[model samples]
Each structure stands twice: as structure tokens, then as C-alpha cells.
Target chain A: MKRFTRSLGLTACAFLALCGQTQAADDIPTIRVGWSIPAEEMKYWMMRRPDAFPDLGKQYRIAWTQFQGTAPMVQAMLSDAIDCSSQAPLSLGQGAASGGLQAYVLAQHVGERKGESFSVYWAVAEDSPVRSVADLKGRTVGVNVYGSGVYGQMAMILKQNGLDPERDIRLVETGFPGSEAALRAGRVDAAVMNQPFALRAESKGGIRKLFSLTDLMPNTVHIFEVCRKDFTDAHPELVKRYVKDLRTAMALAREDRAETLKVVSEVTRAPVDLLDGYLLTDKDFARSADARPDFEAIQQMLDQYQQLGMLPAKVDVAQFRRDDLIQ
Target chain B: MSAQAILQRLGAPLTVLVLLTLWELAARALALDGFPTATESLAQLPAILFDGQSLQSIGASLARMFAGIGLALLVAVPAGLAMGRNPTLARMLNPLLSAAYPVPKAALMPMVMLWFGVGDLSKILVIFLGVSLPLLYHSYHGAARLDDKLLWSAAAMGMRAPARLLRITLPGALPEVLLGCRVGLAMALIVMISSEMIARQSGAGDLLFNALDMALYPDVYAMIVILAALGFALDWAFEHLRLRLVHWAEPRQDAASGGNS
Candidate 1:
């Protein structure tokens, strides 16, 4: 009877030891993510909520930082201040072509589709005489920035309409909110707007959409998730887990609209009505949260940028894409 | 001028040249990818200067800067003079000025835009707000602290208040007022550039920002050079005007120092 008791005690001790080992293995470090204030990248914001992805919080802590644009985001990623971020294809291409950054695609932020996707719009005052892209000649136009995705789309659309982006129209770099203000004030003939701002401008009833990016280039990839090559190499499993958590958050957002809207309103500090105007349609959620990198679309964007003389040389899109991470 | 004076005059330009040379060398040694060498930027200068759009941008920026400073002077000089001559006005305005001086003028940009709309007026008002404070302060002190002996003599000579102000007070205060104008001019340029960068369809700041966004490093550097040259030329012109206007006042050793000296 004494031997039986000793054997039971040893079994209990072994079980406790196994439990402690498992707990130690489950411990997760904090991951820093840089994002902008846009609905497309709000998945990261939603994941921060307690009920959004409980398992994600259990596995890892997230630290979120907001940046104004992808240029500064690239700077942060290069300096190792951020583990990952969302970047426009033009910015990613510029960084890669300049040899300043090497990053792997993790997911898509916005995708282009025929007659469905909402990307960027060229807008004018409601009473303006400008009706089409051809009317842009001798008129001042506004872009978020010159090397940004909006600027690239503006150039492409103007070029397609037989207008030279450089000579035919005066392209001024007016920021997003400022662009709308500039348009209303008659400062610029047209201003490029995206996402919530585009919808907000439309609902405000003063600005008219001159054209959209979809009108010129269909099936174009607008923005993507990127992590430094070194970060991915060091924390391969962490990257996978982060992508999985992001995917889960995306799914939850689509599955539960009311909760997603509440989170979006809180994260953006925008009014619910404005968000409703922005989120009323699936076409508004044209941003794909897919983990797999869209290689064909990315290649097409790279080719366009190369043709525009924005990239120094053509880059191999495959070299920057890591499909295995998502797999 | 003596050879030492010549060397002293050349000191600033020489320092700039050395720094630029070091920048070029460092860029080459480090193989900096996006940054352009000083020489490369210099090579792009003619292109920028010859570009019609760039020239128009420079003109627009200069015009805005001058217009802002001009408006500030129109209001601040008279108000400062009145406050200096009248203690009642001084007591009323002094607290307001003291309170508003420390507030960053850039923080008022959104409010100014809402009031004035996002046109040249908003930018001009921002510059005006930034510059008027320094000008008002200096002008008030300049006119307030007139030599009592000069005023007494003018009064004794039967000079009325208007003539006394015209001859004695104005001449006595010219030096300080010119100093204010010089400082205000610099402030106006700085504010103009910053406001233009924030919201503008055309200006040197806008050109610089657009170039940076396009990754035109050489063009960006070239724009900086142009802006620096423009600022220097304006400062030199103001200094010349100050010397000519306030010839009786003792010249300070440092030409670049502001009104506090």
C-alpha cells in the first residue's frame, strides 16, 4: 500500500511539471504594428478589442502606432521601430527600387475589381465646369503626394485620356482632408480622395467625382501588408500567427457588422453616420484581407511604375513575395 | 576693408562650402542610395531655375511673404505707436500680447482655414499672426522709451504734439523700429514657407514637398538652395534698408541678431 501511494505522488508531480512547461511555451512577446487611420487596415485596430480575437490576445500583445503616410511608415520599418505596416504599391516599389528596404508581402489592404472596387477618386467642386479627365488641361489638380498611389493613378488616368500629367495639368500635393477643403474653396480644379474621405465628400454633396482609379486601371492592387525581410526571417512563426490573427479579425468584421462599425467609429473617431456612408456596401470593403500576396496584380503595378520612370529598374515581384508564410 | 575683415566676411560662405564638400564626400563613401550629392544638386540648379512652373512658384511665395509682412506692418506699426504714446492702450493690450506671444501660431492653422477658407488668405493670416507679435513688441518699446530731453526741447520750441512726434519721437525710435521690421521680415518668410507647405497650390515650399514625395532628391536639394538664397537676399535687403534709415544709431557687431539686442 505504501508503494502505491508513492507511485501516485510521482505521477502527480510529473503532470504538474508538464503543465508548467506548456505554459512557458505559450508565453508571447509584444508585437509592434504601424498602421494608418483607414478602414481597410482597421483589422489590426479591431484585434485590440477584448472580444474581437480572444485567442490572438492570449497568444501575443499588440502595440499599435499610427503614421501619416507610407513614406514615414517605410522609414519606421527600416529603422526597426515597427515590425510590420501597410504600404501602397508605389511606395513599396520605390523603397525596393532604391535599395532602402526589403520587405515581404503579408496581405492585401485594397484590391481592384471591375465595377465594384472603391479605390481613389478625382473630385471637383459641384458647380465646376470640368466634366472629364480631358478638362484637366490648364487646370490645377491636387494629389495626396507625388509618389503615392493616388498620384500614380492620377497620372495613369490622365495619360490614358491623352493628357500629359506633368505638362497638361498642374499636380499639387494636397493632403487628404486638405484636398477636400481645397476643392470646396476652388483652390484646385480636382483633388484625389480615397476611402472614408471620398464617401464623406460624396455625402457632403459639394464635390463631384471626375473619375476613379477603376476607370483607368482595373484589377490593380492599391495597398498591401509588409514586414521587413529581417523581421520575417527572425520571427517566422510570429509572422504567421500575426497574419492568422489579422485574418480572424477580418472574418469577424465581415461576420458581425454592428460590432465592426462600433470598433471602426471608436478607432477613427469619425461619426457613425459618416462611417455608415462609407460602409453601406460590400463594394466599400473592396480591400482584401487575404493572407496570400496577389503576385499578378503586384507585377502589373510594378510594370506601370517602371513605365512612369518612378522605379529605377524593373524588380522581380516574386523575390519580395513569401506565399509560404501565409500557407 | 582689411584682409582680416575680408576673411571674416568670407567665414560664413567658407563654412557652408566646407560642409557641402563633406556632405558630397560622405554621400559617396557611404553610398547613400536616395540622397544626392551636393554637386549633383548643384547640377540640377539650372534646370529648376529655368523651369517655368518653378519660377512661378518662387514668385508666388515671395509675393505672399511680402504681402503678409506688409499687412502686419500696416496694422502693427500704428497700433504699437498709439499704445506707446498712450498708457491706457498699453495697459489694455500688454496682457493680451504677452498671453498670445507664447502660443504656437501654427496650431491656429485649422481655425484660420475655417475662417478664411483654404486660399492665400489663410496662409497670409498665419504668416501675419506669426510676424506681428515681434514687430509690435519692438515698435512699442522703440516709441515708448523716447529720450525725455528731446521731447522737452521740442516742447520748449513750441513744437505741437504732431510735430514733436514727427521729428523727435519718430527719429529717436527709427533704429528700434527698423530692427523690428528686420526680425518681422524673417519671421514672415519662415511662417510663409511653413504655411505654404501645409496648404498651397504653388510656392517654394510646395515645390520642395512635391519633389521630396517624388523622390527627386536632387530637385529637393536644389529647391532648398533656392529658398536659402531667397531668404539671404531678403535679409540683406532689409539690413541695407535698416542701415540707411537708422544711420544715427550705433551699429551692432552681429548683423544677424534680432531686436532684443
Candidate 2:
């Protein structure tokens, strides 16, 4: 009986020790920012520069986490596991309406105006009769899952080209990388592609660039930087500093075009010369210190995508936008 | 071996053609807005396949895959064989493997990134972790199932310990060991795609994610076909090798085993 009690006490002590270690892990000073970057890829692409962050992560601190997919990043922010990051604005808006996360749109990547469209193109075999997005009606078009920003952008593109995404094109969520390969294997007629990927598909002779999303939705659909409201409540200055530094980085990317090309090339592993032509949005990234994100324009895009059944109608997008986090 | 078998061998192309025809019908007849009409998807394949960048990415994926699997086998086989031979050693290391074995390697991507900087090393290690334990379990089980009397008889014949292990123990465990290899190979391919999807800058997995990001459905399909082909070839080769190497250990019901009887 004595041995049993002694062992039970020891077991209790061990469990307490483990609990203490986990709590200490939480207490360690960290700015737990989540980004939907492959961590290795980020180290290769963004952080190689000394000035990418002030004092190179010394002044404040960082505990950067990388998520495999944007969905998890969305969940992490809502659950308070993360404080700040950029994610698909469409998901963020819908998530906010449902009370899953309390976040607000704070920044933008202004690529749409400059022809730097984060677009999905209706591509076909070069010799095929499909000429533009119009010709693609009644054809299978690939997009990511329904609420994903990729589909919203694709829907806007299709709508502009005189085809309703709901009535004209067959939408299937075959998933990434697989979608492109499916197109080439003749499993699907056309799939949307991102930039380096679009460039990649074009280099192959069989596929032709049918139409880009920019041609359809110009300056309407884009990526956003959303922050957890509670984090903004606590470290407002840190968030401001992050924005100030990012604005400068975007500006540096433009003014020092040659050096920027070199850095992006090394980071992206694209040839430096090839990355030279890669597009950037100045109005979004190189914001004037006093400038605020264009929320009305953003809300319009959100509402359009929402009405298109791309985002939830329940999201009061006004609440999704917070000026509190803006520097 | 027969004409009917030959007909079966020629079925793959016919199947693909039949599938294409049905796809064409679906788009034409159903006015399907949800899928690509047949002809557009087929004509896009060849041009996408010959891409220099795409080919390079495939080659990169293959190289890393082999590197990860090869290093895992080198460590796993010998270590597993040793643990299989000695219960004392197995007991000592059992907890280490058990504690980690159930932790899904995919969930550890963030921790892996923190420690290994999200490079090739991290990716390889993640795949390695997923493969090694299954191989170890197989090795240990294979050893335990060995015919003890055979080893005893070999020792009675004055066979040296090393010679007995090589001639009797190894041959006895091979059937189970090969089964483990089949699983390990499939698992390796799966982890390769998952790791690339989660963490890497390039590879077929990266290609798929980028394709999704861009909404190039055709290109996404093309990558899927390539990865599928790669997996099929790997599995087929392993099966063929298994049949050839372990022919002597054919199941009791097989023609070879009957001949031996």
C-alpha cells in the first residue's frame, strides 16, 4: 500500500513537470507570427536581406510559423495561436462573419492595377478552337475549393468575359499542382495558374494563354494582410512597425529594381533576369506613411465575390476592416 | 503467357481512349460547366510534358526522393536487423521509436522548419521518419517468426554464428522484409509529395500547389499524370524485384513451392 501511494505521488510529480515545461514554452518571449510560406522557401526568399526586419529580428523578437495551407493559417489566427499574417481576404471575410476569427484587413498587395494580376487563365491547346474565356462555356474549368480566393478571381474573370461561372463553365475542385497536370494530361480542358507557373506552362508549346483574370476583374481581386484584433489591441506599435518596414521593403523592391531582382531571384530560384519582368504593385506596398488601405474598393471586390456565392453573405465586411491596426 | 494475357497487356491505351471519348460526350451532351471538354485536355498534354522547367522539376524530385529513401534503407535495414536479433537491444530502443512512431510527421512541419530551416535536409528527415519505423517493425517481426529449430540444427552442424545468421536467419526473414519494402516505397512517394506541398520551393508537389494557385487546371492535370506514372513505375519495379529475388520462398500453394516438396 505504501509503495502504491509513493508511485502515485511520483507519477503526479512527473505530470506536473511536463505541464510546467509546456507553460514555459508559452511564456518564452515570442511575436508568434504565422505566414502561409514554406518556411525554408521564406528563408531563401525574403529574410536573406539584413534590413528585411529591423535589427534582423533582434529589436523585438519572432517565433515564425509556416502553415501548409491557408485554411490552417486562418484557424490559427482565430484560435489565438497566431497574432498577425496575410491570408486570402475572402476566407478572412467569411471567417469574421461566422465569429471564427476576430481579424481585420490592414494592408494590401496592389498588383491588380499594374497588370500584375494574381490570375487564373483559361488556357487551351494552341491549335484548339477555344479562343477566349467566352469560348470556354460548357467546358470544365478547374479552380481550388469554392471559397478560395483563386476561384473568386476566376469567377470575376469569367463574368467579365461574358460567361457566368455558375451557368457557363463547369467548375471542379481537383486541387493544386494536380489541376495543372490534369490539364496537360487532357483530363481537364483548362486550369488557372499563378505567375511563375503560368510562365512555366506557356514555355511549353502545346498550351496557349487564353485569357488572364486581370483582363476580367482589373484591380478588383487581390491579397490582403489581416491581423488578429486582440494582438492589435496589445502590440499596436509592433504591428505599425511591421507595416512601416514592409512598406519600405516594397519601395526598395521598386527603386532598387536591379538589386531587388537579384534578391528575389535568389529567393524564388527563378533566373534573376526572368524575375526582372515579374510584376509589382506600388500603390499597395509602397504606401505613403499617411495612406490607408483602400477599403471601399476592397469591400466592393468582397461584395462582388460574396454575391457571386464566392464568400458568405453574412459577413458584415465593415467589421472585417479595422483602421485600428493601420500605422 | 497466353494470347489472352497479351490482350490484357494492351488494355491500358484502350482504357485511356475510352475515357477520353466519355469525357467528350459529357461536355457535349451535358453542357457541363464543371469539367473540361475532352479534346482540349488531351491536346494540351504533349506540349506541357516536354517543358524544360517541368522536366527539371521532375528530375529534382526524383533525386531528392532517392536520396531520402536510400539513406533511410541504409540506416533502417542494418539497425532493424540488429534489433531483431537481440530483444535486450529492442527493449532499450523500443520506447524511443514508440514515442515518436505515432506522431504524424506532417504535423511536425513547423517544428522541422524551426530546426532544419525548411531546406532539403528537413524534407528528407521528415520522409525518413515516416518510413523507418514500419521497416523496423517488419524486421523485428520477421526475426521473431524465424524457425528456431533450423538455426539450432545449423549450429549442431558446427556452423559459425555469423554463417548461421547469414545462411539461415536472413533467408527466413526476407519474405516479411520485402513486404515491408513495398509499404516503405509507397509511403516514401506519399511523403515526398506531402513534404514538397508543405515545405519546399520546387518539385511535383510544389508544381501542383502553384498550379492550384494559378488555376491552370490543365497543367495541374499534367503534373498529376506524371506523379501517377512515377508511382506506378516504382511500385511495379518493386513488385517485379520481389517476385524475382524471393522465388525460392514462394508460398506453399505456389507451383515452385510444390516442386520443392
* Top model number, lDDT: 1
In candidate 2, what are the lDDT values of residues A14-75, reduced to their tens digit? 99999998777655444566554221222222355755655435445555554556666676
- Residue lDDT tens for model 2, B1-261: 898897799788788789778878886785432355666555656754776766676777777778877887778766776677778999998899889888877677556655665557777887787778787778777877887788889999899978866777677888777888888888888778777765454576656665444344555666666677788899999999998999777765656467663
Q: Score the docking of each candidate (DockQ).
A: 0.01, 0.08
Query: Interface Cα RMSD per model, in Å?
Result: 16.2, 8.1
Expressed as tens digits, the lDDT of each residue in B220-252 for candidate 1 is: 788788878877998998898888877768756
lDDT of 1: 0.75
Model 2 CA deviation exceeding 4 Å by range: A1-29, A36-46, A65-69, A78-82, A97-99, A114-135, A142-147, A156-164, A172-194, A197-217, A281-292, B1-129, B136-193, B199-261
Per-model TM values vs. the true structure: 0.52, 0.55
**DockQ class, candidate 1:** incorrect
Q: Which ten residues in a row have the lowest lDDT in candidate 1 chain B?
A: B207-216
Error of 2 at A99 (Å): 7.3
User: Which 10-residue span in candidate 1 chain A carries the lowest summed lDDT?
Assistant: A39-48
- lDDT tens digits, residues A14-62, model 1? 9999999877756766666767656553454454465566656667766
